[model samples]
Structures are given as structure tokens and as C-alpha cells.
Target: MIWHHLFQPFIEFGFMRRALVVCLALSVSTTALGVFLLLRRMSLMGDALSHAILPGVAVGYLLSGMSLLAMTLGGFIAGIAVALTAGLVSRRTPLREDASFAGFYLGSLALGVTLVSLRGSSVDLLHLLFGSILAVDNDAALFVCGVASLTLLSLALCYRGLVSEAFDSAFLEVNARRLPSLLHGLFLALLVLNLVASFQVLGTLMAVGVMMLPAVAARCWVRTLPGLLLLAALGGALSAWLGLSLSWSAGLPAGPAIVLTASLLFFISVLCGTRSRLADGLRAFFN
Candidate 1:
């Protein structure tokens, strides 16, 4: 009975099956990246970058009217451009990196919303903002799976550099003059790619929630980097499964349901994780 309740949806419906695949893939990749982001104190940067892609997605929509390929390319371009621009501003000016990111993301988000509003209806805007995971066509599924695979592979290759840079960036800089910068750029590229891929599943607004929330929740439970990565992935997978189940049973929007599930897990972690390492880590992160 319990088994049938959980397993029947995927077995009976192709859309449900595809959603599960995409969700699981998305869960693993995004949460892994989220661990790195959290460690780097760039947790909210995922949120900023997620919004920063809006203009490009809006542009692609204006040009192609819902062509996934076009939107993905445009989003990638836009996200990368914003990341680079923010980095350049921080490097050249007195402004801090976070401030630069905030300014650029606000501008990008406004521009995107305006562009979307001009050409697309409110419904279109809603779809772009919230996503329609149940509408996963074969093309979308393939693209997401490919992105997930690429993300995991890239993370594997860059693991050492990422960790070294995260914990002791100056050490990495002294040892390998250009490696830090290269890793930073590569990491940003991967971040943008994952955001783009996630936009397909969870939309731009809610995408980073799935990425960061599970990682944060995992942090509450574990102290080690590997433990955080593992727990975050499992949390993400749990959110995907539970969210899909909730949406299926309640007829709620799948994207928000998934995010809400993550949020629930975060609250649970907060309640249970008092005095845990997460409290100290978060304090340090914000400070």
C-alpha cells in the first residue's frame, strides 16, 4: 500500500517518470555545487546568479518563443556576462564583490521582467518564474541529464582546486599563480550551467532554493565536507521525491512544492541542529 502509493505515479505516467529522473539528477548536481558555494560563503550568490539569467532567458523567449535551446544559450551567456562583470567591478573598484553582484543582479532581473512582460503574457511569465516540471519533454529531459552529467564530471576534475580555494585561497594563489582564477571562472561557469539547467526544472526564482537549502540543511547535520556533500545530495533527492509526491497528491505546483519541501527540511534541521556546527558556520558566513 505505502509502496504502491509512492511508486505508482512514476510507473503509470511518463511525465512523472521524467520528472523523477530530472529531479534526482538535479538534486545530486545542484546540492553538490551548493556545498562548495556554502563553504565559499557564496551561498546567496547562487540566488543572485539565478536571477541574473532572467534577461537572457527573456531575450531568448522574445526571439524564439519557448525554444529550450535558445533560452539555455541565452541564459548561459547572460549569467556568465553578469558574473564576469561583477568580478571585474570588484577587482577594479573599491566596491566589494557581494555589492557588485547585488547591483548587477537587480538590474538584470528588472530588465528580464520587463522584457518578459513586453512580449509574453502573465501566464508565460509565471511559467518562466515557477517552471512546469511535469511538462518535461524528451528534449528537455535529455538536456537536463546531459547538464547534470557534465556538472558532476567538472566538479570531479576541479575538486582539489575548489577545496583549496575555498579553505585557503591565498595558499592556492601562492602555489599556483593562475589556478585560483581559473578555478573561479570554471566554478562560475558550472554555477551558471546548473542554474540554467535548474531553471528548466524549478524556474529561475525557485531554482537556487533547491540548490542552497539542502546544502544548508545538510550542514546542520554534518561537520565534514564529504559528509556535507553526501547529506546534501540525499536531502535534495528526498526533497525531489517528497515534493513530487506532494504535488501529485495535492495537485499543487511541482516546482514550489519541491522548494517548500526543501524549506521544510531546512526548518527541521534548524530545530534539531541547535548548537551544532551549522550555527557557527552560518555565523562566520554572514560575518
Candidate 2:
């Protein structure tokens, strides 16, 4: 009885089930990380890190013959390396955090492209850029689930420290001693995991947008952190579902379609949300 709706897609075509599962996992995990990123005002880091991991993935493919675990590990290492480098540069030099991130990630992306061009075919490059949700296998799905569970658990355990650091870093610094830095490290680790899990579904380019845009849109409407997280997750999940359906019906690319749906929702939220500039202006004019 319960299988009737899902069975048509799952039983009729293996790709459909794979697509749905991959997108669902991506939505949940990415949105969860987006919450903390948004609060820290480090939202753009998602884009930077996504791009920064490209070279690592290319290297992984070259060395390991396209193993998902190897690629994910490579990407994870690259992301952490970039993060640590950015932190050091920001602390030691006059460069700001954003500038440092932009420099490192853009460089990483260019390097990745160059390396891929040297060894990989055009199709391989395209796959790395756009990704194939329907191609997700059991191993990839299990890996995503495992990462998501770990991310959720870590975030739950570090909630107090994370919230304090995000909202009031100085307070944590004065009272909790090492708590702020600890939370910061945890957030970075979660971001890396989310990127790894999402790379297969959204690719490096679209993953950041999917992770951040929904959270930004949700933020304009919700005041509380928990509410913002829940709304962002809902927005992400809805976008994933809509995007999958549309792509299936129209025979379009799933990754771009999903990102486009999320972008549209963001614009809608900007127009209709309570804290939106348009809404505020309208209210003032009416009043």
C-alpha cells in the first residue's frame, strides 16, 4: 500500500530511486551545515571550499581510477588545507578572511581544471562539473548517510558551543576559554563532510548555492536559529523534490535544475518574506 507512489519510480527505473535518495541526503546534510555557516557570516566559504576541492578530486580520479571514497577523501583534505591556510593568512597578514578564501579557492579551481584537462576527457570534466545523481550507487549512498548521521550527531553535541561562538564569540572567548575555537573547528569539519556528500549530486559549483541560498532565504523570514534551520531544510528538501520531478519530466540535467529551483525559491522568499526589503517597504507605504 505504502509503496504504490514511490514504487512506480523506484521499481520502474533504478536511476529514479538513486536520484531521489541522493538528492534527499544532499538536502538534509547541506542545509544542516548551512545554518551554522549563515550565522558565522561565512556563507561564501561554502562556494570557496566547493571550488577548492576540485583539484583534489581530479587528483583522486587520476590516482585511484574514480573511486568515490578516494575522491571524497581527496576533496576533504583539500578543503581542510584551504581552510587552515586561509586562517593562517588572515591571522598573519593584512588580508581579510574573505579575500584569503577567494584567493585560495579560485587558485585551486584553476589548478584543478588544468589538471583535469591534461589527463581527463571532455566527458570526465563535464561529469566533475555537473555530476550525475542517477549514477549514485549503494556505496555512495551509504557513505552519504554515514556522513549525514555523523554531522547531525556532532552538531547536536556541540550545539551550545556552536551557538555561543556564532552569536557571541567574545563571550565564549572570555567565559568558555577554548570552546569558541573548538566550535569553529567542528563547523569546518561539518562543512567538509557536507561538501563530500553533496559533490556527487550537486557537483562543486551548484553545491554551495544549494547549501547557502535556501538558508539565506529562510533567514529573511525566521528570527530564531532553530526555526531558520528547519525552514532552510524544508526549502532545500522542497527544491530537491521539485527539481527531480521537473528534470525527470523535461529530460533536463538534475543538478542545475535543482539549483535553479532553489534560486527561484530564494527570490520568492526575498519578495514575500516578512523581513524582506520588499515586504518591509510595502508595509511602510501602506501604514
Candidate 3:
């Protein structure tokens, strides 16, 4: 009976099924994006973008009664806006990209929270910040699937351009007729979409953590780009499954639990990975 009840939730409850499906879809997209973000040394920007979406989400909630669509659009817009602002600041000032991102995201986060407090109930604010998988519905599931499809397609179509720009913008600019700036914009858009879809499962704060930690962990073991992406997806999906199970069993928050699971996996990878820096240090010490 206990097993039946535990498993029955997935079968009988539509929301639970939707949540699982959406989480799986997002895991794949975010994992791929994470690989590129890590390579570009822009991992922290993922966290910043996630937080920057808060005001957009709040505004969406206020404008339309539909939480899912509103939040998705709002978050996407907010993420792009913050990224653009950070880029402008970095270009005009002497500040580094990371520093600019940090400043902008923190300010955006504070603004979002203040706006949410002014317009929404305490419970609504908590839900936006923490998230609840049990609240996922059919529309949210469809939205997640749509975003995932677009991200995958965009990446595949622009793979050559993206790789060129990422490796050497100057080289691409000199060699290719296409503008590197266009490719860069596309990458940023993909990042925003990835972040928006992930927000449902990881919330704003934890989404970046989930996206980056697994990729970082996977990099410890894999040298090739494809291998890294595959490992990161495996890590992300495993975390999602384990985190959902733990949340159900312990009556804890799912988003935080999922992020925690990813973090733990990262720690393990750091400790035991054959290619890890720590592994080399330990090997030298032992020898």
C-alpha cells in the first residue's frame, strides 16, 4: 500500500506526471547550455540571470492571470535585459564581465523582491522564490517542451557559428562573412530560454546552481565536449529523479532538494574523478 501510494502519485496525479516530464526536458537543455557556459567562463552569469528574472516574473504575474506563461516571458525578458546591461557596462567601464553581472543581478534581484512584496501575498512570493513541483500543470509542461525544442534546434542549427565565436571571436570576425555579434546574441537568447524553463523546477536562485554544478562535475571526468555534455545531462536527470523522490518522502521543497542533489554530485565528482585536480594532488601526495 505504501509503495502503491508513493508510485501512484506519478500515475494518478496529472501534475506529478507533468512535473516529471518538464523536469526531464529541462535537464537536457540546461545540461547542454551548462557545458558551453562553463567553457566560456560565464557560469556565474547563469545564477545572475536566474535572479534577474524575478522582476519580470512579478510583472508577468501582475499583467496576466496565467502564472506559467507570464513568468516564462517575464523571466526571459529580464534575463536578456540584465545580460545586455551587463555587457554595456563592461564595454563602457573597466569592470570585468563577472563583476558587472554580479552588480546588475544583485540589484535586479532586490528590485524584483521589493516589487513582489508590494503586489503579491507572502505565499505567492515564497512560491516564486522556492517553487512547487506539485503545482505544475499541463500548460507548464507544454511550455517546457516548447522551450526545450527551440533550444535544441537553435543549438544544432548554429553549432558551427557558435563554436567559432566561442573559440575565437576575432578569428571568426576576420574569416567569416557572418557577424560574430549575431551568434553571440543567439547564444544569449538560448541561455535565457534555458534559464526560464529551469526556473519552474529550480526556482530563480537554485536554477543556476543546478545548471552549473553538474556541468562542472562532469568536466572533472570528461575531456571532450560531447562527453561532457552527456555526463552533465546524466547528472542533471539523476539529480531531478532523486530530488523529487526525496522531496516526496521527506515533505521538503523540491527545487532546493534537486539543487542540493546536484551539488552533492559535484562534490563527489571533485573528490573521486580520475581527471580531477584533486585526484592529481592526492595521487602526488600518496606517491
Candidate 4:
């Protein structure tokens, strides 16, 4: 019965298998990046970037008419632009990074929504807002895998700089000054790339939700950065499986199912985390 319920869907349907693959691929890069962003106190920054991509997606669709390549590229470029601009504004002016990101993304979101509404049908809008993971084809899979691999490798190479930037900018010294925004830009590029990749599989909202929930849950369990990354990845993988299984059996939408699964994991961690958060809170209250 268990095999019939779980294994049968995967074995019987190509789309089911592909959705699983997409989720697994997303876990690696998004979990790590999500942890990093949270460390930098830029968790909300991710939300801003996700919304900012809508304009680009709309423009791409308008120009190329539902071409994945065009929309992905357009979204990617827009994401990078928003990141860089936010970074620049934070550095050059009184506006804080989060505030700057907020300003930029809201504007972009408005523009994107307007543009998309001008041309596409409700079906197209639904696809853009929530993604159609079950419809992911071989080519989209390859693109996602490729982006995941690149994000992992690139972050690995720049690990030192990233760590320094996050925790000890004062210690960054010569090399950090030399590159200035190079490493930061690379990281933003990965963020954008992952957004684009996940945008295809889970849509903008669920993509960001999946990444953030696991990272936050993992944070509750572990204090160390590496531990957070590892646990988040595992949590993401499990959420994906649970989400896929629920979607297949219950007939829920794939994006919401996956995100809800992640949310469940997050809440569980908050209540029974390794850190004993709930227990500590109860004890404190009783005392």
C-alpha cells in the first residue's frame, strides 16, 4: 500500500519524477544561499528580489511570447540590476540596504504586474505567479541543474570572502577591498540565477518560500553556519518529497503543497527544535 501510494506515482508518471528532480536540485543552492542571506540579515532582501523579477518576466513574455529562455534571462538581468542598485544606494546614500531593496522591488513589482496584465491571459498569469512544476520539461531540468551546479561551485570558491563579508568586514582588509563588489555581485548573481531557476519550477513566491522556510527552521536547530546549511538542505529535500506526495494524492496545487510542507517543517522545528526553544520558553514562564 505504501509503495502503491508513493512509489507508484513516481514510477508511473514522468511528470511526477521531474517535479521531484526539480525540488532536489533546488534544495542544494537555495538552502545555502538562504542561510547566507539570513546571516547577513537580508532575509527580507530575498523577498524584495523575488518580487523585483516580475517586471523582467513580463517584459520577456511580451517580447518573446512564452519563451522560457527569454523570460529567465530577462528576470535574471532584472534581479541583478535590483541587487546592484540596492547595494549601491546603501553604500552611497543615507538609505539602508533593506530600505533601498524595498523601494526598488515594490516599484519593479508594480511595473511587472502592470506589464503582464496588459498582454497575457489569466492562465499565463497563473503560470507566472505560481509556476507549473509538473510541466517542467527536460530542457528546463537541465537548466535548473546547471544553475545549481554553478551556484554551488561559485560559492565554494568564494567561501572565504563571503564569510568575511558576513561576519568580519573589518578583517576583510586588502583582498576584500580589491574586489570591492565583485564577490558581492557574484553572490547576487547566484541569488538571481536561483530565483530564475526556481521561478520556472515553483514560481516566484513558492520558490522564495521554500528557500526561506528551510533555512529559518535549520537556524532554530543549529548555531553554526555549516550546520544550518546542512540541516536546511535535508529539510528542503524532505519537504519536496512530502509536497510531491501530497500533491499527487490530494490533488492540491504543487507550489502551495511544497511550500506548505516546508512551513510545517518550520513550525515543527520552532516547537521541538534541538535548541529546546519551546521548553525553555515554558520554563521561563513558570519561573
**lDDT (tens digit, per residue) of candidate 1 on 55-127:** 9999999999999999999999999999999999999999999999999999999999999999899999988
Best by TM-score: 4
Better candidate number, 3 or 4, judged by TM-score: 4
Give the per-residue lDDT digits (tens) of candidate 2, residues 115-205. Answer: 8898889888888888877788888888887887888788888888888888889988999788777778778878987887788767888
Show pairs that collide, candidate 1: none
- The C-alpha stretches of model 2 lying farther than 4 A from their native spots are 1-11, 277-287
By lDDT: ranked, best first: 1, 4, 2, 3
TM-score of structure candidate 4: 0.95
Report the number of the highest-lDDT candidate: 1
**Candidate 4 lDDT tens digits, 1-287:** 77876788989999999889989989988989999899888898778889889899999999999898999989998998888888899999999998999999999988987898899988888888899999999989999999989989998998878888888666675545756367677888899889988989888777898879999999888988878889999999999988898898899998999999999999888888987488679888999
Sort by TM-score, best first: what order?
4, 1, 2, 3
Q: How accurate is candidate 3 locally (lDDT)?
A: 0.82
User: Which one wins by lDDT: 2 or 3?
Assistant: 2
Residue pairs whose backbone atoms clash in candidate 2:
none
Candidate 3 — worst ten consecutive residues by lDDT sum? 1-10
Q: Provide the global lDDT of candidate 4 against the true structure.
A: 0.88
| lDDT measured at residue 129 in model 3 versus the true structure, 0 to 100 | 81
**Deviation in Å, model 2, residue 95 alpha carbon:** 0.9
Better of 1 and 4 by lDDT: 1
